[model samples]
Target: MARAVELATVLGSDRVDQALGLAATAGRFADDDLVSILEHIAASKPVGEIVRADEAHSVQSGTIVWQALGQQPTAARESTGD
Candidate 1:
């Protein structure tokens, strides 16, 4: 709860606080769900771009998002470093 509150504070947005409140109450969630949530929050790009045949753009966008989350890479940090 404290960690969620702290993260909500850092985010400094009512939307984030509300979402965190929900998550904290609901307890843990799956990694893919979390990633999907993050993608929504960051508005990285449309799902089409992510699933496009051009692997380079998809890889680049993924890299940008992974780095934003303090991760090395999805494959490297799939366990969430927990």
Candidate 2:
């Protein structure tokens, strides 16, 4: 759940939910695919670059408290063209 929220903070809730919902509905084969989807989302450059100061503060604070490690292998897979 914490990982999901960090992802959502970076990518936005709508996108996170959209991908997660797809994974949930796409049958058992989607488990590995789940990591792929998150990789795709994280790799995407933000379409809109606007940032409110408070939102930035919130993300940093949350990360410090949550202390979650990023799922880098998934990100690396997308970067390496898998």
Candidate 3:
């Protein structure tokens, strides 16, 4: 009970309440059972995933830059006319 209160100070009351309920349901009351269940619950929650837009724009590093790598500069090409 004291340990649960300590955890609640950091992890919040709602999450601790849920963990206690799960521990009771699973009949787990060992020294490390609550901690393990709380860790599992925290791990299962996603942090975040960044998703980028695929819209067409000049700012995007498209293949046009790669194609230009093998070509001469505009001034040099103009002199060669090739």
Candidate 4:
């Protein structure tokens, strides 16, 4: 919950609004349920894109989220035995 609040603070309303607009445009999510809309957006983006976006947009929040998610290793990391 704290991480969510931090991310919300970092992203602000404008960025969120823009993302929602984009989601609506790309996935016709305007009338969809929240879960369906989120699923559509997640399906549309590659994992790397999602990770990079989180890191680039809000490093601290991203770190918190990644940690909370158990900081799973990426494919490249596993391949290289990092």
How does each model score on lDDT? Answer: 0.55, 0.68, 0.84, 0.51
What C-alpha lDDT, on a 0 to 100 scale, does residue 22 get in candidate 1? 51
Q: Estimate each model's TM-score.
A: 0.28, 0.37, 0.52, 0.25
Candidate 3 worst ten-residue window by lDDT: 45-54
On TM-score, the leading prediction is 3
Candidates sorted by lDDT, best first: 3, 2, 1, 4
- Which of the two, 1 or 2, has more TM-score? 2
Candidate 1 residues lying further than 4 Å off, grouped into runs, are 21-39, 44-82
Off by over 4 Å in 4: 1-7, 28-82
Which structure is stronger by TM-score: 2 or 3? Answer: 3
> What local lDDT does model 2 show for residue 71?
45
| Total clashes for model 1 | 0
Q: Write the per-residue lDDT of candidate 4 for residues 1-82, one digit (tens) a residue.
A: 3433453477565544545666667764443433354455446765355444454576353354556475556875688884
Off by over 4 Å in 2: 27-33, 40-82
For candidate 3, lDDT tens digit of each residue in 47-76? Answer: 365555667534567676687877788998
Candidates 2 and 4 compared by TM-score, better number: 2
lDDT over C-alpha atoms for residue 40 of model 2: 77
lDDT for model 4: 0.51
